[model samples]
Target: MLAGIVSAVLAALVFGGVAAPAQADPLPQLATIGSTLYSFGDASLCAGAIDLALEAAPHHPGHVLAHVTPRGYLGGPCGNQVKLGWVGSAGLQTRDVYVYADAAPGETITTDLWVGTGPAKVMAIAWPIRSTFAEWYLLVP
Candidate 1:
């Protein structure tokens, strides 16, 4: 369940989706803002959309750009509850952020959300740290 949310966040920023609609710019295949709906169209044209949304406000919507989850690890960057947040410091708007790993409960993750770049390949960073154990997640751009 957690992994799904992280993937949804990952889908938002990666560049690879359908075509843009005739009326508006290439719509996002599945976009949102703090549970608020946005848009979606061709799966290709809007590939870089999620990245754009996160670029606008990575914290508001709680899109963890810390790291990419491993091939099979689906544990998202959240606790058992539904509250959303990040593991490291705040995200830098306008820059490219990379998903490092899964931010588990009480974990520490670090991601670079560049402060001047356009919508590109920002990833979902997830860093889950335990007393002596640690985990991570990285997104694909």
Candidate 2:
């Protein structure tokens, strides 16, 4: 049931550029110990509200799950919407984290990200008016 919901949401993003309904799937409670703030683009032109988490994959050994939720934007004309993505070290495979759609203001998009345990750089890019909004580095354990 949960898998189907997740797959459907991912399909919505990967195939069509449409975002999933904000109230779609619910994830299991994993401890959210901390969060990081990020400002992207030249001279910190834009900022985004996002939360990140890294935890050991419940079943996949040597891999970590990165939970990224793009809450919204701080202020100003942050374009029509924003999107999330990541860059990881070489040889570390990644899945589910490649957010390909735009998230509108006040809309929350949570990703079921799985990647090989290592260092990673998460990024938030603004929409139609293309530009990077924010970025942060995470050491996936």
Candidate 3:
């Protein structure tokens, strides 16, 4: 009876330490130079706030605000609301993407966003989302 009890305890202990597979998910962060008014990162919260700075960007295409590695999207904007839907292939390769923006510590640049998922069809169920407010400039690399 004692041996059985010990075995059960050992099994429980082993499983107690077992870990779950890490999921690929989006992340958000803010720069140190960010102003108090400029909104920052939040995994659970979706707050739209802007800041102020000295200069603005020309809104270039090659501009890479951030680089997503695989299977997840970073936190930021894409571009104009009209072009956001056409930027990515809508979960084409099941890869990752990092979305970032350009502005001073406290600046406001606005743009649109395109959100979707895989294990589905070529056509995204969700489409064009024009951001009501933005900082200045951003990209998804």
Estimate TM-scores for all models: 0.17, 0.36, 0.20
The ten-residue window of minimal lDDT in model 1 covers 41-50
Candidate 2 on 35-88: residue-level lDDT in tens?
A: 533433222345554455544554453344555555544543342333445565
How much is 92 displaced in model 3, in angstroms?
31
Worst 10 residues of 3 by lDDT: 118-127
Model 1 scores a C-alpha lDDT of 0.27
Q: Name the best candidate (by lDDT).
A: 2
Collision count for each candidate, in order = 47, 0, 17
Return whichever of 1 and 2 wins on lDDT. Answer: 2
lDDT digits (tens) for residues 22-85 of candidate 1: 3312312222222211112122111111112222224323233332122111333322111123
Q: Any residue pairs clashing in model 2, and if so which?
A: none
Prediction 3 TM-score vs. true: 0.20
Q: Give the residue spans of candidate 2 off by over 4 A.
A: 1-81, 89-107, 130-132
Task: Kindly report the root-mean-square deviation of model 1 from the true structure over all alpha carbons.
Answer: 21.1
Which regions of candidate 1 deviate over 4 angstroms? 1-104, 124-141
Give the whole-model CA lDDT for all candidates, comma-separated: 0.27, 0.46, 0.28
